[model samples]
Target: MPKIALAQIDTVLGDKQKNLSHIKDYCRKAASNQANIICFPELVTTGYSLDILGTELWTFSELRGGETDQLLSSLSTKFDLTIICGFIERGGSLGEIYNSSGVWVPGGKSWKGTFRKIHLVDSERNWFSSGTNIPVFDTPMCKIGIMICHDAGFPEIARILTLSGADILFLPAAWCIHYKDVWNINCASRALENGIHLVAVNRCGKEEKINFFGDSQLISPRGKPLTSTLGDDEGLVFGYVDFNLQAKTRLELPYLRGRRKDLYNIDHSLIV
Candidate 1:
C-alpha cells in the first residue's frame, strides 16, 4: 500500500513566495503522516489569474531547473517523498509561457519529469502555449502521469496514459465553481474506463475574480473515492493507493485487458 496526499490549498494570485510556503507546509504534514507522494493544485505557486496578470507574470515563469527546481528538489530530499506541483514555465522564445508541472523525487536533486498542460481553454489561449505531448514519469515506487484542469475533460488523454503504462494519474486543477457536477462525472468516468488510480487535487477559495471549487479527491482504480475534501478550505487530505488492489481491479473490470485493437481503429476518410 502506498500512502499519498493531496494539498487542496488556497492560493494568493501572483504571490509566489506565499503560495510556495503553503505547499511546503502541507508537504511537511504529509511527510509526517508517512506519505510516499504529495501533490499540489494547478498553478500551485501562482493562482489561476493569468487573465489579470497577463504578460506581467513572465518574470515568474521558471526556466527548467531554475530556482523553483532547486527548492522542490530540496523539499523532496528533506521529506524523503516525491513532490508533484504545477508552475508557470518559461520557454526559449520571447513571450513563450506554458502551464506546466515540476516533478521532484526523493533522494534526488533534479526533476524526474516536467509536464506542460496540453489543452488551453477560454482565456488561457491568449496567455500560454499548449503542450504537444503527455509524458509519464517513473518513480522508485510506480509510474505516474500528470494532467492539468481542462485535460481532465478529455477521456482520450486518460486512455493514452493507461496505454503508455501509467497506473496512477495525477491531475492538478483549479476548477471553477459552476462545473462541479461535470467535474464529478468526468473523474469517475476516467478512472473507471481507464482502470487507473486517480489523484485529483483541486484548489479552494476565491481569488479576486475567480471562485474555485474545492472537491479534491483520491479515487481508486475501481472509481471508488478513497478520501475526499469538500468546500472551500485550505488543508491536506490523505488516501491509500494499493498496487495489488489496482492490478486486481483492472483484472475484474477487463477494460484494459479486453481491448481489441483490430476493431478499435477509427477511419476518418469515411466521415465525409
Candidate 2:
C-alpha cells in the first residue's frame, strides 16, 4: 500500500510567490505524514485562468527548462518525493501554449509528460493549444499516468492510459463550480474502468468571477471514494493506494481479459 497526499490548494492568479509558499506548507505537511507522493492542482503556479488573466499571463510564463522548471526540479529533489502538478507551458518558436502536467522524481531529472486539454472548456481554447498524445509512465510507486483538467471528460484518454499498463492515474484539474459534479464522476469512472487507483487534485477559490469546487479526491480500484474534500477551503487529503486489493479485484473480475478488441477494432463505432 502506498500513502499519497492530494493538496486541494487555492491559488491566486499570477501569484507565483504565494503559490510556492502554499506548496511548501503542503509539502511539509505531506512529509510529516509520510506521503509517498504529493499532488497539486492544475496551473497551481498561475492559478485558474480568466479571460483577462490569460491575455496578461503570457509574459510571466516560462518555457520548459527555464526558471519555473528549475524551481520544480529543486523541490522534487529536496523533498525526495515524486511531485505531479500542472502549469502553463510555452511551446517553441511556434508561439503555442499548453495546459501541461509534469512528473518530477528525486535524484533523477524530472520526466515531463504533457496533456493539452483535448476538451477545452469555455474560454480555455482561446489561450491554449489542444493536446494530442496520451502517455503513461513507470514510476517507482507504480505505472502512473497524467491527464489535465478537461481530458478527464474524454473516456479515450483514460482508456488509453489503462491500456498502456497505468496502475495509478494522476489528474491536475481546475474544474469550475458548475462542472464540478462531472469531474467527480470522471475520476470514479476512470478508476472503475481501469481497475486502478485514481488521484485528482483540483484548484479551489475565486479566479476572477469563477468559483471553483475544490473537491479533490482519491478513488480506489474498486471505484470507492477513499478520500475527498470540497468547497473553497485549502487543505491536504491523504489516502492509501492498495496494489494487492487492485490485483485481487482484477484477478476475480478480469474485465480487461474479456475485451473483444479484434471485433472492436473492425468498427469502433459499431454498438455492441
Candidate 3:
C-alpha cells in the first residue's frame, strides 16, 4: 500500500517563489505524515491565470531542469518522498511553452518524468501548447500516470494509461467552480471505467474571474471517494492505494478485458 497526499492550495498568479514556498510547506507536512507521494494542483508554480498573464506567460515558463525543477528535486531529496507538481514548461522551439507537470523522485538528479497537458482548454490555448504523447512513469511504489485538468474528461487518455500498466492516475487540475459537476463525474468516471485508483487535486480560490472549487479527492477503483477535502480551501487530503483492492476490483469489473477493440475504429467512413 502507498499513501498519497493531495495538497489543495490556492495560488498567487505569476508568483513562483511564493507558490514554491507554499509547496515546500506542504511537502514538509506530507513527509511528516509518512506519505510516500504528494501531488499539487496544476500550474502550482506559476498559478492559473493565463488571460491575466497575457504576453508575460513566457517570463514564467522554464526549460526542463530549470529553477522550479531544481527546487522540486531538492525538496524530494530532502523529504525522502516523491513530489508531483505542475509548472509552465519552455519547449525546445522558440516561443513554445507548455502547461506541464513534473514527477520528482528522491535522490534523482532530474524529473522522473514530465507530462505536458495534452488537452488544453480554450483559455489555455492562448498561452500553452498542447502535448501529444501520454507517458506513464515507473516508480518504486507503482507505475503512475498523469493527466492535467481537461485531460480527465477524455476516457481514451485514462484507458491508454491503464493499458500501459499505470496502477494509479494523478490529475492535477485548476477546474472552475462553474463546472464542478463535470469535474466530479469525470474524476469518478475515469477511475471506474479504467478500474484504477485516481488522485485528483484541484486548486481553490479565485484567479481573475474564475473560481476554482477544491473538492480534491482520492477515488477507489470502484469510483467511490476514499478521502476528500471540503469546499474551496487550502488543505491536505490523505488516502491509501491498496493494490489488493485495485486488483480485485479490476477482476470483478473487467472493463479493459472486455473492450471490443475491433469494433471501435477511428475511421470516420465506418460510421453509419
Question: Against the true structure, whose TM-score is highest?
Answer: 3
TM-score of every candidate relative to the true structure? 0.96, 0.92, 0.97
Q: What TM-score would candidate 3 get against the native?
A: 0.97
Q: 1 or 3: which has the higher lDDT?
A: 3
Candidate 3 structure quality by residue, lDDT tens digits, 1-272:
99999999999998889999999999999999999999999998988878888888888988767888888899999988899999988887569899999999999888887999999889888878889989999876888999999999999899999999899999999999989999999999999999999999999999888899999999999999999576788989999999999989989999988989899878888789
Question: How would you encode candidate 1's per-residue C-alpha lDDT over 1-272 as one tens digit per residue?
Answer: 77888889998889899988888888899999999999999998988888788777798898867877888899999988999999998887677899998789987777887899998998889989899988889886789999998999999889998899986999999899889888788888899998788998999999886889889999888887888576678788888888888888988999988889889788988888
- Residue 210 of model 2: what lDDT? 80
Candidate 2 lDDT by residue in tens digits, 1-272: 77899999888788888887788778778878888788998888887665768666676556767666777677767777777877787877877787777776776554455555566777777887787777776556777888888888887888888889888888888888888778878988888877878898888888778888888888888778888575578888999988898888788767677788887666556757
TM-score: the better of candidates 1 and 2: 1
Cα displacement (angstroms), candidate 1, residue 127, comes to 0.9
| Higher-TM-score candidate of 2 and 3 | 3
Off by over 4 Å in 2: 228-231, 266-272
Top candidate, metric lDDT: 3
Full-model lDDT, candidate 1: 0.87
